[model samples]
Target chain A: MQFKLDRRVHYSKRMLIATPVIAIALAVLVSSVLLVLLQKPVLLTFHSFFIAPFENFYSITEIFLKFGPLLLIAQALAVGFRAKVWNIGAEGQMIIGAITASAVPVYLVDSTSALLLPAMLILGALGGMGWAAIAAYLKTRFNANEILVTLMLSSIALQILYYLLLGPWKDPMGFNFPQTVMFQDEALFPALFEGVRLNTSIFIPIIFTIGIWLFMEKHFGGFKLVVGGLAPNAATYAGFSSKKAVWSSLLLAGFAAGIAGMSEIAGPIGQLQRSVTSGYGYSAIIVAYLGALNPIGIIFAAFFLAVLQIGGDVALVSADLPISAVHVFQGLLLIFYLATYTFVNYRLRIIRPLTHSNTKPTP
Target chain B: MSTIEFFLAGTLSAATIFLLAALGELVAEKSGVLNLGVEGMMAVSAAVGFVVTFESGSHLLGFAVAGAAGVLVSLVFAVISISFLANQVASGLAVGIFGLGLSALIGRDYESRTIAATEGIAIPFLSELPLLGPILFQQNIVVYLTFALALCIGLTFKYTRLGLAIRSTGENPHAAQALGFPVFLIRYCAVAFGGLLAGFAGAYASTIYTPLWADGMIAGRGWIAVALVVFGTWKTGRIAFGAILFGMVSLGELIAQSMGARIPSQLLSSLPYIVTIVVLAMISTNTARMRLHAPFSLGETFDGVGPR
Candidate 1:
């Protein structure tokens, strides 16, 4: 009645690809049981969760709209994750990004110059980088754990956002609301197509996907980062600095997250609001892992996650399901994915007990 | 009550929550596993404890159920990180996210519900003592338990063979494994214990401290507990001190807000987290001290392999 896991000498590629698919299937199966427990109509809930998101052009566009931030943040995170540099504070970084990007619209309310958008994007990226730098500096110089530092920084970032929204940035004419005024037309992102919320910022992820694919697959720097992650001692033996890996990876993630924040404010949100603290930064972590930390995989993974998010919203309205159901689904998805991912590197086996008579005979 | 007394009283309860959670994490980290799902575990247990207490009308039963719920969530984390040999950080994050979501779902119905606050027990002779008695002796049973737990844990680490085993396990799992200790099993237990305490802390928040069930009510106290472990340099006494210090700081902000401080409330709210960052950075800056105090295998996954 004993079970054991034996590590495989070579990882199975098939299992690597199949793990996510199997994990998603398993998550859906388990979630159905949860729906039953929650007393929701399982079939109808499933229909809304899996099928209804694609029912209309608006919802489909909404999926891409959500996909924009997830893709950018995940790709940015995948870079650091590949380097074993955990920057879980992208949420804070994204917040800072949004805040920094808003400065232009908030202060230069009447400006129509085209440079405003570009300047805002740059400032947003810098803001995210600045926030991430705190973590990086601590990790590199003081040997602080980046995970805790980044997370703490995110809380600080949120407070800063709240302070601004509640104090300085509160729209003077919006009847005491704790939000900024809508951005001017110059600050807003131009739509990419008619009849949808999708904007030109979609190209950022598309371009970065190719850029990351090339950087990871072909660049020497990327190879060094991989080496740093895989074998730290060997990396040091080859003269690769771990500190550089930490900085580059975190800064890259910060930059991308900053862009995500910028796009969120400029594209979909159109202003810095309390709602911008939505868990895109956290969800992107799942997206990064779900994509197996690869660019191509991240695209599909981000798309699936976006669908879940958008579909979860639909279920909230149509199936009378709790909004927390989506969070539960995501959490379950990550757990299941991690569990199934083990099959790529290990195989399960059953161990039978030896009979006492046989042992006595041998004696 | 004087402002100082009010502050001390508030600090005692606040410190208790952090202390309970931090003590659990201390044991887990000492055994060489870092469970970052404290936030999620607290959230779930908060919801569970609140709902159960609201329904059963027994705070004791609520605390017990909350601890069980915490253990259940931690078991999921143990399976993922220990059995599956997944990345501990990623696994912990997943557990955290899942716990938050699950708790929120369970708490949806109980959002507006409130429970009677747990009354502080007045020590017959001690309550008549000067300032110290009111601050220390007159507190909820859980608060006293938290202090006792810290003392027991401290004594355990210093005097017990079990403490040595845990220390050795965290210091060098491979060596411990070769010595016939079941590394994975020990880690699983440690993680589960951490969850239990974190759950108790959450229960305290929902059933006693605030005495209300709200989605996400645990609100970063779990994280503060996590930081407190590091801030204390993973020692029991220092951890208690750090918890009390943070508790005071947190309460100070509320007091400041109440006293008509001009500073934005959000800025005041951010004080504890910012302090955590600063203190963490300061402590970590002396790499020599950090390396000495921190378990060498703190976040490393242990395979069931003997030393080669």
Candidate 2:
């Protein structure tokens, strides 16, 4: 028997909603096999990966801390992804943003101005936009592939961060460590609770969620962006500028990633250091895809990923599993998600072998 | 050998890594398949190659196993992007992430470990020559093999039916299918071939060039190899030449340090990537040239039974 993929006349909405759940289940199952291969306790590992992060208040706060950046970056990336403008260099943009925002705190070590934080945020956004704008210009003017360009820029950005930390930005009074001075209180976001790292910075992502939802679901501009991605020819026929879509989507993503970067330095990190990004840019891509590129779905997806990230840390101590296991899980999750997503639009059918009786003569 | 001669010789060894992978990518792209997981594939192979060579004390066996591992991993990408009809970019990224994670997992314990470097095999008379001998003839076995592979691939594209079939399939899958070519099979072979060479390059890097196991050692070389195809405009000879040019830039980092140049090492290390961006922008600006050389069907999904 031969297998065939038959396009569904009308896809079931249930499958569309259920796909992420199925993908998660499949990822867990596959990861269990990997755990068994490594001679680790599958049950305990699963506990840490899914349950341990929620057992206590501190871990819960940690989840939210991670959740903020993932939410912000994923929402921004989803917009561009919907418009089919690939910007995988959010990490680089975030780094640049962090650098630009830190300029305010680094240079103004004694400032008590209330506007300093706002200025930093704006500068961070501009930094990210300026970085992403380079790719936009190259893509529009030279037709260069954004994927390669952005990725290369990410590598370059890392070097720049290292150069600064090692050379100029090194904290002078605090030994020769490769990091800048901690920000003053005025440059920092206020903590939501006593002794907790979770801060008011979380409001940024919450606000962005609602904003993106309204924009994509209600605004005509968002409709045009979606159309441009889904059908470029139709979008062009209707006279929506694809170039503008590319520029806006990339710049917006850069803007969001930049804010996420600034929040990182201003909230929990409180200083410019080497581990600034922690792969948030890459993880946000998975969140974007897992959420089906939807605003509301991204909320849940980002939260889930944040929990898993916290859990992955717990497992490092409790289960003795390598940190790479989290990356492996993420990879499996995305692969399974992409595989199962195919069923949303098409159904598989088995074709019976053609017998002589059923066979038609050549015309 | 003088500094210039030494630089040329070092450049070839450096270029070998990118050349092998780029040549493979050239073939895969020629068949209208864009597998963006080369970095991941090389990472996995590099880890596996280092471990195997260290354990078994045979570089050949390590390379063989690495190539097999690459094929196995790349088949995951092949099945997902091709058979499952997933977005090629997303699928490739997932595969890349998975490979990197897997490689790190495999090499976690093997970090800081060293392996014996593969020694250069000298040609009898050619080794006696002064200038050209050290620069070209006297090198490790993998270097000579890569050069031979590049030549063979270039010649095959010009003279062979299989080459025509692969190129035509890349140019237009529907027309190729109508003309009785097995598009899927050819693409599968092309991707697998690309995987094998990437594996070889990775193994060469770990077992011969660096002779050590380190997490993330493959770095951005795989991506540079991908860019090299565009820089060379998808031609075999030009891609090989581009790889050597990058090799010189990469070697310049070491040379500058040795010379005690005042420039920051980070800037020098970043030169290859910067050059890749600049070269890509320059090459891609010529739309007519890109249109002439690029596979028309590259990155587009081909469905035989879809309602077109």
Candidate 3:
């Protein structure tokens, strides 16, 4: 007996929505087995892993705080991914944005103008776009693989961040620690609610989601990009320049990732530090996929992923599970989702081996 | 040993890790599959190898288990990317992320643990030779095996039918399949073989090179291995050279820092990754050359029913 996969002519909308749900269920089941193997109680671990994050108002706000960056980055990445122009180095771009945005507070420490915040956000977006432009230029001119170039560039960005923090950017008055001085009141983001760490930046992703939905669903440029990805020959025949698609996709992703980076320092951190990276860039990739690369889907996906992160932390203290187990769960979610995504386009069927007649032997 | 000798020895040991992994990736790519999870595979294997060696007190067992662990993880990759026809790049990334998390979880207890370091065996009579003896004749068994493996791969590609089949499959899977070759099976084996080598590389890092278990000890060597394949233009000899070059670049930082160079340590630390990007760009810019050497179906999914 053999199993065969038959390609479906059209993917059903129902499966499109159901696949992620199924993948999550499967991932939870697998994690339960893993928890058992580790000698942790499955029920208690599950409660901490999935349920504990929403147990309080503060933790709920924390989830939104995490969601802000992830959603922004994922939405940005989805644009590029849809165009088949992968910009995996959003992490690097985000870092550059953080640096650029922080330059305002670091250089103009005494300035308290209200315009400073908007200027920093713009500068942050520009910084990210500038970093992504390197990959864009290499990809367009030199035909370098964006995947490798972007990934390598991310490491370089991290190193640069380390260099600045440990050297030039180190706060002189802070006892030689490798971090920058806290931003002034004007540099920091205003909190969205009293006594909550969540800031106005949360609205950034919410607004971008609507903007992305319009851009992807209604804009001609987006249609061209989708054409380029789905069928390059068709795109070329229609006179849509692949170069423009690549540039637009990367720049947009860079811009969004930059905003995310700026929001981190401006919102929760209020200071530039090495820990600002915190895997937001990488996690955004999983979020982008989990959201099915749609604006609305990305909002939910980002929220789900953020909850996982917060829940993972809570579980670390309450369940005695290693913090790394959270990372493992994230990884498993992606793998499982990718595996189940196949079902959206293909159905499995069992096949029996055909028997051959022995007429020649009888003769 | 003089600084030069020390650098050379360090370069050999460092290069061996990349050489092993890259050679395996080269084979997998030749058979028309790309496993970007090399970093993750190495990380997991490093952790697993460290724990096994620490508990069993046998480096051989550690190395063996590490290779098996790599294969096991890669099998997950194969099942998803190959069987399910998922995007190869994303699948590889998932595997890598999974490996990292799995390694971190497994190595939680083993953090900061040290093991008996594997020592290089001195070749009889050759140890008496000045300068060259310490650099070449005295090295760990894996270092010698790397050289042998490179030679064997080169010869196999040039002279063997299996190599021809793999090259043919990578070039045109449809043609290979129509000609009765089992494309999926070949790719599966190729990917599995890559995993085994990656595992060995990881084990070597934890048990021999550093002789210590630490989270992320493999660092970015796995990614370097992936880049080396492209940098070498998929050639065994060039891959070996690229590995040695990267190994030297990585060690150069330590040498510079130890010698009290005033450059920021972070800049020095990033040299290898920077060089990897630069080298990748340089090699990839020559499209004609890349087309000539890169497997045509390198990352394309074969669903067993298509002409493509």
Candidate 4:
């Protein structure tokens, strides 16, 4: 109704911090309606949709199971986002990383070691970085739009995954599915706890996230990159190369996404499949933004989105809402997030002719 | 889809989608607000357009509705990025995400159902020409309009006073602002125009190509068009060239699959995106060209309240 922003408020910090919460709240409200559409009671559905996911350790582990790669990709995109370099190909990078990391266990199936798993993880990270670098170089050198270039390049990475899985990586011993040979026990990620589907890959994203957060907060390198993104002229005057910032941010993001891809393949998936793509990269775009590009925030956003995902699947089985319906809910969440963000930023006004008859300003 | 026929169809389809969108983007970039939500706008428009055509069986009305729908969505992006001075990338990303969700939700009923699309309007004698004839002459009226619109847009930018004003606004908004040009209005107009094209592009894909709506039906075509704007280095001819090449690449995957080629089809499907990178790298390699050719005001939102 009016400009009600508090003068004493640290508006920037609050806006940044509250974005994810605001988005989640909006997502819940929209999803509740979707539940109603599915013939479930709104209150009951809200309880089931949001509350049920966190009810027990079984579901909590399920959260972490989905959270690992999402957190990784979100953090990765956050790095690029911090420097204003958007890498929207985390899904492609994830698939390629999975495919490449799967190379070790699938090819070297007989070879077994704890060392092999870590090595494969490193390879996956490298693969993602390698894939991301293509777009980064194009951006830095050719001055191409990184968002478009990176997104397009991601399709290429996905194709590589399809080619390998359908051809070279096809599992000979398994049924006629387009997939790779299963990894050896040594190449598999060790579980963090027994009786849970989640594995140790969750630690990879968290460790990288802390390292990134520290790098952004404490290091001059990140400061320079942030400055370059925020104010190019000032950054140039300060002698920080914008090109380097773009390359650094994108490369780091690529590395993280690749590693996340690796963890997904090695940890839970064990074998590569076409069903590997589940919109992790694109969804991470939401996660990264909703988290306000913060490491600590991404951890929570990842879990929340993972819950949305698993809950969507649950709603499909229990509520009998199809995947399309769940997607509609997700889409609505994105819209609600944007819509509410407008309110967060600006207070709308309804202008009317000041009629003498109805001229009372509400006290 | 044979080689010649496939190529002809793909190029026409690509032209229709890219023409107005790129032209609209050209104006915006010239003014300096790089909007990435074109894909999202297009996706939403495609759905809206399909629905309209499904109900009305009129391509003209569908195009109008789709363009209006796109503008409505883009207006949200424009206000957020241009007026409120929110982060352009963030605002655009929000616009895209919101539109995508909106499209999927609204388009649920139309999914998997084909609708009557705009039919090819064959040129009398030209249609009977050699292999090149149908590919070039036997396109729907939208195809001709898009091609002609590119010429008009390109010529206007190069020759007209308004074009100069738009160019100046993009090049140095502060200077233009000093000279009394309403930079924000110009940007709004440019964005709205771009949105119109983007929406029409989506309609072209839905009503023309696939003819049936599906979730994510536009596939990454919107992204490809955005990439082409860059790959073209902001030149109308180059953008059209890039788009046609992309169209060919898109059709090539289908061709390969149809030919019983054992090569993993996904690899071929990725050709368009890969080419976008390769072409962008080659053309934009010259820093001077990038600096000179890039729409001067691309991506930087104007606060109109003096520089922060």
Candidate 5:
């Protein structure tokens, strides 16, 4: 028995080390077959994917630009996931935030104040929270499935974006286009450097990282949420309200998603549109898990995901890969990451079937 | 306004897709695993069905191809989670993501492609009835098939030996194993069955309802189907009712828009999600309120080997 235990532990350790490497090699091999079908050179296609993202500074910056929103949303999701509160519809919450925060500059575009941008951003966060709270409230009050509520809300948010773009928020000066009016000088997020899309949005992520780390490390609320997830019955016995934890985790996610939404519009697009709420809200779930649901780890994971997005775009333009190929790569990464963990905490064994006459016979 | 007529048409339309997807999820949930790839499977199948039907002009061929594609993707999920012992939640999510990606890639050429759909297969005498006519008889074959499937499923649960084994595998795998039932085999079959149903649902949405393929045509309906299982609280009868309610809400916005109602159409469009949240809250809060339903061992991953 002792010998078997040691062998099993050693086997697991080896599997853990080789798992990601093996999965990536397999994924790359599969992608090569796909490329061959596309009548593209597999060697060049492979190079353009793994190495080209880091080949130039220009591409690197673009990667960070894409990583910004993913970082924010993934961090938000990690909070709720750790607490076991599934907020699957960050896309809807994101759109709500973008629409809400854009309200300041859309109607009050001319208001030049030091506080206008900050105030609008805060409103954006509130919008995301408000959207998430609907799910949280329903779940807490009625035991509604948060997953469905969130997913359904995302579609509704898409419709709402279309309505806004077509109706009051439509750009009057433009031709027949589905987009909101561009923000004025005051509303646009300040760029930190010229010729670069990078801006104050990076600070939001930095602050969130520190805040989440400290909250998880030091705060009572954070401890309760994590503990609630690890042992729900113990939490209840210890007088912790599972409902309170649910609200906090959900509300925090909303806030983070909301801010990310606002950042998307204010920093990059500088306007509200149907495309404002992309699949980042949903993809962040993968990002959260890939980061191992840890605050510090998520930062690296978010950045890595951002690189994949950038690499995808680069491969699309230079290597002649379609947008779908990048998405496929992302999917491959998710599958590999998820599959690798099988070797983490589990040990496998086989034994002969039990012999019992008391049990009912199978037909 | 003939609200009853409108509601009936809307509900049946919704039921065609929801019933198919929800039934598949029901089987998966019953097998002690939650595979959240229903939405992704639907999306992949939707695109595949659209492309096939567009080329062959045969709805049957398209439906079959879609189902095969869905099963193929779900097998990957089953292999990772069931065989590898990967976290079911994460593996399912990965499968869903992969499905979406695969569908998008394979169906890229079929974007904006339109095809002939599965039209209503009307029953003779039933179609003549006033209220129940359009409600039941005048719908496509899939809608009628759903009712039959529901009945057969319920009967299988109560009377069939195979059903009993499936149930035992879910409730207690160790007990099932000692009794000579292969728990893993039962779960594998259940999940694959779910994939087949989900594929049909996706194909139905693409071929019959929309008759066109888009990147995100399934949207989040698969997720909605997952919640339906919880709301039905695990009873096939109640789930059918719950699926109809969801279907109605889903079609409500379109019905309102078609009728040219004065409501801010966007807010009305969101009613499905709002109702989903409300219904879910109601069902999940009180065990009794769940209508004495819910699978005995839903979403619990069985390792197939445990202490007796």
Candidate 6:
């Protein structure tokens, strides 16, 4: 007997929808086994992952709170990822965005101007773009690998954040912790609910979702980016600039990440601290791939990951699992998703041995 | 010892970690495979190496086990990217994240634990000479091994049939396959070897250099090693030079901090990453030179059929 992979004549739409489901199932199964190995309550841990996030109103809002940044960052990353322009350093861009946005409130401390938030948003985006632009410039001008440069920039950005937090921007009245002064009410986004942390900032990612969906699905510029990713030579032959694709992809990703970063400071965080993004930039990469780089698909993926994030936090107390376990689970989901995605392009075929009589030239 | 001698010795020790990992990555890239999971692999090795050494009280045993763990972790990357034909970058990132999480899990209980640093081996006559003798001849066993490995790699690439085969596979796998080379086997072996060295680098960090188990201890060293390969333009000798240069810069940062320099330690700590971005840009600026040195099939999957 022999096995072979034959290319499918048509794209498998069924598998496209089912792939994430299967991947999630496999990840859950594997996590259950791992939990058992760790002597944790497997079922309860999973309850926290799958059921706990939806158990109450606050937790539900918590999911959306997490969803906002994940959605915003993933949508932008998916676009750049599609263009084959890797920008793994969104974390750094996000940090820069947070810093730039916080600069407004940090300097003014008592501002009641309604324009502060708006200014912070734009400055936040520009900061992220500026950070990302460094990588784009290096990539286009010198052919430096953006993956490495962006990652390096992330490390540097973190240091810069630390420098500012520990040095000049350290809260004057606070206990000398390495963080900025809290933003005034005018600088903060209006809360969506009376008690919950969810804020009007959630609208930003939703608006971005609609905008990116239209641009990717219904625009010629998006077509050019796709072409640039799928076939660089073809894109070049068609008069599309590959350099433009690189610049635009990185800049857009930076822009979205910047806004996400700004929203975090202006919304739930209300201050620039050490753990601002909480590895959202990296986790959003997983979200982007889970959605298969589709703008609409990312909305669901972001929500699902948001649940996992909240659930993981819950499990920290309920299951006595460490925070790293969530990272492990996310990694497994991506690995399984990538593995199963192959079936969409190819199908397995099995061959059986022919009978001896049938092999005798069929009489 | 004089301060300069102490600094030089530290530089050499620091260089070994990057040297070992970058050498492994260099070989893997030569065979047209890019395993970006070096950071995660090193983390796993560091954690495992520390735990093994802590438990058994044998650094050698720790290094061996850590090296094995690195190979096993990298095989995850090999199967996903090579066999499943997934995107190499994404697969590598997945493997990297997994390794990091796994390492954290493995090292959770061992945090803050310490082990005895590996003792330096001194050549009989060479140890007593002068500044040069103490700086160069006296070092840990792993350091000597790394130096030897680098020399062996340089010689192999210049003189061996295996080297030619790997290079040809990187340049054009189809042509190499048509010439009857087993491309898959070569790539798998190359990636595995890269994992082994990465593991060694990690083990050295946990077991010898720092002799401590700490979360994220490997830090960005793995990424720096990856950049070192590019900074060297994929050449073994130049890579060694770049590693030493990085080692010196890192040591210089430590020295500056200790000297009560007014610069913030955070800023000093960030210097290496900044330098890496700059050097990467500088080295990559010459497109012709880069094209000539870089493996044509680097980060690309082999379809296992005729050329696409």
**Least well predicted 10-residue stretch by lDDT in candidate 6 chain B:** B299-308
DockQ of each: 0.83, 0.84, 0.80, 0.42, 0.57, 0.83
| Candidate with better lDDT, 3 vs 6 | 6
lDDT of 3 by residue, A140-221 (tens): 8878888888888888889989988988888999898889999998998899888989999899988998899998999887
Q: Residues A213-293, candidate 4: write the lDDT tens digits.
A: 888788888788888777778889999988888888888777877887887777777778887757787788888866667
Write the residue-wise lDDT of candidate 4 on B121-180 in tens digits: 889999888776778888878888888888888888889988888888888888899999
lDDT of 1 by residue, A174-227 (tens): 798878999998998898778678998888888888898999988898899888
* Fnat scores for every prediction: 0.84, 0.72, 0.80, 0.48, 0.66, 0.77
- Per-residue lDDT of A1 in model 6: 93
Q: TM-score, B chain, candidate 3?
A: 0.98
Better of 2 and 4 by lDDT: 2
The residue pairs in collision within model 2 are: none
- Candidate 3, residues B126-205, lDDT tens digits: the string is 96689988888899988999889999998998899999999989999999999999999999999999999999999999
Residue B124: error of model 6 in Å? 1.0
Worst 10 residues of 2 chain A by lDDT: A354-363
Each model's number of backbone clashes?
Answer: 0, 0, 0, 4, 7, 0
lDDT (Cα, tens digit) per residue for candidate 6, span A1-363: 976666788969899888899999999999888888889899999998889999999999999999999999999999999999999999999999999999999998887998999999999999999999999999999989999999999999999999999999999987999888888999999989889999999999999989999999999999888888778899999999889999999999899999999999999999999999889999999999999899978988999999999999999999999998898899899989988888888787788889797689743
lDDT for model 4 comes to: 0.76
B208 in model 3: Cα distance from truth in Å?
A: 1.0
Better of 3 and 5 by DockQ: 3
**On a 0 to 100 scale, what is the lDDT of residue A149 in model 2?**
94
Model 6's CAPRI class is high
Compose the digit string of candidate 1's lDDT tens values, residues B1-308.
56677679879899999999999999999999989999999999999999999999999999999999999999999999998888888899999999999999999998878987777998899977788778877888888889999999999988998898888899999988888887888888899999999999999989998999888788788988999999999999999999999989888678897788887778788888888888988888888888899999888877676532
**What TM-score do all the candidates reach, one by one?**
0.97, 0.97, 0.97, 0.88, 0.91, 0.98
**Which number leads on TM-score?**
6
Model 1: residues with Cα > 4 Å off, grouped in runs: A356-363
Q: State which candidate, 5 or 6, has the greater DockQ.
A: 6
Q: Let me know the DockQ for model 4.
A: 0.42
- Writing each residue's lDDT as its tens digit, candidate 6 over B159-218 gives 999988999998899999999999888998999999999999999999888999999898
